[model samples]
Target: MLDGQSFLISRAVPGSCEQESKWIYMTQHLLESSSNKRPPSQESEEQEQGDRGKRKKSPECPDTPDITDTEHALDLSDRQGSDGDYDDANSFINPLGRDITISCLLRCSRSDYGVIASLNQSFRSLIRSGVLYKLRRQMGITEHWVYFSCNVLEWEAYDPYRGRWIAIPKMPPNECFMCSDKESLAVGTELLVFGKEVTSHIVLRYSMLTNSWSPGIVMNSPRCLFGSASLGEKAIIAGGTDAQGTILSSAELYNSETQTWETLPAMNRARKLCSGVFMDGKFYVIGGMASNTEVLTCGEEYDLNRRSWTVIPNMSAGLNGASGAPPLVAVVNNELYAADYAEKEVRKYDKENNAWITLGKLPERSVSMNGWGLAFRACGERLIVIGGPRGSMGGTIELNSWIPNEGPPEWNIIASKQSGSFVYNCAVMGC
Candidate 1:
């Protein structure tokens, strides 16, 4: 297996005093609370240590072939430090104490967690315990990272907040996966990549906690070319075709916390190549092929509380071309938006009228082939478009963004890098 050095790039992002003051207040509150805490008993330490030990390191894959690393990627050995091992596995920053250490670390950017984990065993154990992220969620602190793949076997994560790129480890070698079409979704701290093996469909998952890829738990009914979306620790997968080439209306809900899948009530329609999104506390599946030759214009909304599907007619009418890819759509702040590939324009959904209003043109350089290679997603409050200019000889891929408002769209180029192709799959993980 290739133990290539993970890539890191830093760009200065302007900070505001208001944000800094808020952090100071939160840190002070946590510190004050810690000062009133009593000493932990021996049983508490043992239990906490055992919980950290439960996250077994994934064994290296055997017979894995090596792949070339990207240019400028660093080596893992060069990033190591000389830290003495801690006698107490439960200790986190012995000098500062666990509570104080956690309070300080919470103020740090999520992009720095990987480097923090390398400080010592205690820090590593704390990260893998998943407590910091849980606490972050409770505190309403979230950082959105865009995880995308331009190559079949490799993935890169972009931290828009810090303007950094992290190269993930190469996936385990599988001839079947290398050539097959794949789908990707990021739920909680895990990135799930769905593809097919020789005889069956499989899921390969990459976890931020482990910083590694492993075979994932499969769905109750394994399918591909489906519509899927994630909300916090849960994700829903709807209509698609099974391995036997049968279109299915069957759906399944996955809980990343439990690492299990629950079969969901089937959708009203069976379609393949559809796209999914979460809006207003509901899951929506839009635009796909109902059969080999027929395209679907209607969309379905799945209500979790009622356990039912509602079909919205003309929900995607005129949005998808007859032979085009799945409707390129995303949701930000519970408002829906779609990219009109044929028109090179952006449109927003009017919830009250159940119609789409054309907003403005997309980024001039953001090109796509029937919406196949381009990715439209909501990274927090911004609507981002990821794609490269059209050419047979591929070049740099660009990430552009625009915050929706009453004014016309003014796109800003955030990041770009040389690549042979546009994004094959992409997902946003907010933690």
Candidate 2:
């Protein structure tokens, strides 16, 4: 029988030991350079916290040593390794080349990445460099995880693939942020939660790589209640009211790789409380209030290749009510689907006819307040509905899903837990 190391090598490379040994190591300097520094989000948070006030420590967000301290330790490790104190441990795997090691790691479930990073300095560096995830993307290997908040300060993630729930670190306590309206979006490996803090707006970011929350970079417009959507490593926010309470036609695009926002061409009409989605390789903004009293029935499409917007009349007809939340919309396989909260039904967009066709009813027990507290999103290949049942004594949140096909909808109750009946925010991250 093959030994343990030989078996692992065979599984990763699928050939003789000679073939496995041929795999060349990735450039050491590149890996170290990418992973050695702290993420910009963390560095910014440290500065912001000092400017704001002393933060109260929570159980979930225990105090972590500064990245500078960690860097010092790494320097010591490097010196010791040069002296032969830890020659083998310096490599990602003891004897196997890094190229082969990363091949096996890419096949491992994403849920195990956190645990794997904790094993040693070398493993941690590889994971933090973000190379592995980028390579995985190029290979078209991905897993989708759902992130949502039931309480003001708490967030939870559900791994649909593994059917496991993960508790995210609690957001820093702020009276203004806790009580204000918020919106959420997941781009790349970061989950951004936007809210108002007193006179100005603030963004709190949670990084999957670090498993920590930090102050995020604010947009150029710095508005609330905007329509936003993500595609791969980038996200776009469009058509929301500025801090001055003026409806804005301005928009911005965010690139997670650079952690920067680039201003985009404004839409034809200014609106707020709209919804955004990516479909058929284009971005669409639909159904929002033109002003305090004027509700817009039109939708706008942005063509990335052309860098322009086309206004489609009556595209969002009857979708947004005067006082309801933004139209609950999501896209799967380049097809648009929306949740009709008032009608308690699911509808598909008929682009050819410029209309919506009712598919089926929503979950019977799922409840919402004028479509405010319900989350309807596309989770990979399934349509997901997250909400609480009506008339429950205390509170209970349920996650129901259905894979769309030729037939009508038949949802499966995947998970439920005790929490506030209302969802504060929700976003799905596919990576």
Candidate 3:
């Protein structure tokens, strides 16, 4: 006989097929059940651990707690009651049954907090709305452009972005007969043009709104080349040349609303080519040529409210020609600036310290002829000097340029054309 294991296998091989199949099925069932009950695989376990590590390293979410009604009501109650003491006997009593009503206290508390949050949101909305409203108001009206006129009473407007001057239509023939001069002052939308053409002193009012010229009330005295100042709705004309070549010390005011003229007390000295500036509700007159055969170093102030003249300290040097115009009397850094003809320099008068200081030298000589017809204009923060004859050159001409106090300062030549003989009345256009 064969060994016991070989003899048993041979016997079951063909005859025990059914039992072998049952045994195989039982073994597979046991193996599957055991696998189902077993722990995870090592790779899967390591993957889960990696995921946990990533989650642990990640940042936590920010705190955003939800406030409930009961908490809010408690806060409000605490705020209202300072001492935190409550009397049970004095407490409000509810008529409805507690269980039947389910006590709307929570609802009431929720309503109160809701109202508070709503009010806060509304206040913030109102503030934002108000700021937007103000910004819109400011944006509605912008300083779009500015025009300048030098001679012939002509104005040229410029488009800064386009870098070109726009031509305004000429005044009508009948409307064009009015006198033009370099002594005119433009304040806001009104132009106060004064001239002594014949026997009478006249003022022509040019309205920027209407774009037309109308005859204003005549002055009490016949004058030309006078200095003027605009205060509020009124204009003050002072110190000009009379028809008979007499310097005028008298001053008059023009009211825009009433279209009337009022005469004020005369200045202390007769002045021609004088400069007047309106500052702090008063008129300050600077240097000019006087009738006494002397250039005036004397300065005077005319109070608009008081209607009186008080003399101030003289300028460092006498100023004549168009330098007596308001453009020269620029208030920079709380100080008055004027071109000094006597010193051939720009001078500053400090109102706070009450002193005069020479600032910069002029381009030309200190002679009176060099200074005559020189127009000064305050352009932005710089001073612009327009067309004027330089010295006794007769037919020679000088261009316009700007002078800044600080930074890189230089003269920018505008025009070099000969201004012809006796070019004593030059004006700037579109500046």
Candidate 4:
């Protein structure tokens, strides 16, 4: 509901030729791209036309313009300088010298304000040594709630603004209420949690206003370690291990309005611990382990409107373990990113060009156990990594905010409690 304005700030050295040229090139790119798009709104279009008419006519060029030739030559020199300066400047900045800090405003009910404040203070001390790049307020689902399968299947709402996590009423336990490696996705006011116990199944509906969980529908097949994402009004679940411990290629969809689960076409290959993201109205499934025998290079996509699956380019590196859970696939500046659990590297996928590039490596080693409960969210404009194994729970980092002059940022520990929270398989709701 917050329609805040987004701003960009640049602080390069004054009059630096490399910085100036790069800025100009980026501006030109934006101008050309905008020109090809649809015209601005009617009022803005009229304003633009009026401004054009008000411009004074330029003087006619002489037989040979004095500045034209020099300008043309300088353009070529600037282009050459751009390439060299980019490389030189990048080399000068250490890849590991950057630091980022992430802050979140915890809002809870008036009764639980003190608890929320404690969390905020604890988080501040946890990452006080690092730079903060992200700050987000957690979205509350009714009065302070937390949903867990093993427990009473309760719901709690946390108010980051008030600093509280309040527990809501309990839900009726269904026939099979157990879910391991549970993954949840949020669409509007509904939360969809999918997991596998003895069967691969999904718990469809949880409303923040209702403050309770009700059975909406179940998946066509039960799956574990699957990837889930929300696109518009629908939630998509794809690629996971079935009851038999075999990786699965199938996918399912749940329409929030219809309150039903429908089968979509399966993926190209069986994958568990794969990363999935919904971007530009499509679902992208990336790397994971297949059959416990091989790490998969398979990637696929499902069209929301068409209800079809298509094989897409695979990831640069295969991922497995805790790295393939709910928030693994993150969209930063229109590009898809996933941390390769097996490779300990982060990769970015360019949807426009169908290419994969290594963004960088994780600050620490990879963790392979209980690969679930990892959560990633955009705090402000920076991507915040939270709650994964191998020093991840308290660990946080910024995405793509680094520049050549600024160097690669460091991961700051945000929450160091020994709660041993599963980073990959947990549900995250943020404002």
Q: Estimate, for each residue in 305-407, the C-alpha lDDT of model 3 and write its tens digit.
A: 6878988765534445433332256542224567765566776666766676776766552234445545554432344554445446544444444445553
lDDT of 2 by residue, 342-374 (tens): 999999999999999999999987899999889
lDDT (C-alpha, whole model) for all candidates: 0.74, 0.74, 0.45, 0.44
After TM-score superposition, the amount by which residue 120's alpha carbon in candidate 4 deviates from its true location, in angstroms, is 31
- lDDT, model 2, position 350: 94
**lDDT by residue for model 1 over 202-312, one digit each (tens)?**
999998887789999999999999999988788999988888989999999999878999999999899998989998889999988889888898999999999999999
* Candidate with more favorable, higher TM-score: 1 or 2: 2
- What's the true lDDT of residue 83 in model 3? 35
CA shift at 216, candidate 2, in angstroms?
0.4
lDDT for 352 in candidate 3 is: 67
The number of clashing residue pairs in each candidate reads: 0, 0, 4, 43
Error of 1 at 220 (Å): 0.3
When 2 and 3 are scored with TM-score, the better candidate is 2
The local lDDT score (0 to 100) that residue 259 gets in candidate 2 is 91
- Where does the lowest 10-residue lDDT sum fall in candidate 1? 44-53
Give candidate 3 regions above 4 Å deviation. Answer: 1-153, 157-164, 171-182, 321-328, 341-344, 352-354, 362-368, 379-381, 388-431
After superposing candidate 4, which stretches have Cα over 4 Å from the reference? Answer: 1-181, 196-204, 241-247, 321-327, 342-345, 351-356, 360-373, 377-380, 388-407, 410-418
Q: Rank the candidates by lDDT, best first.
A: 2, 1, 3, 4
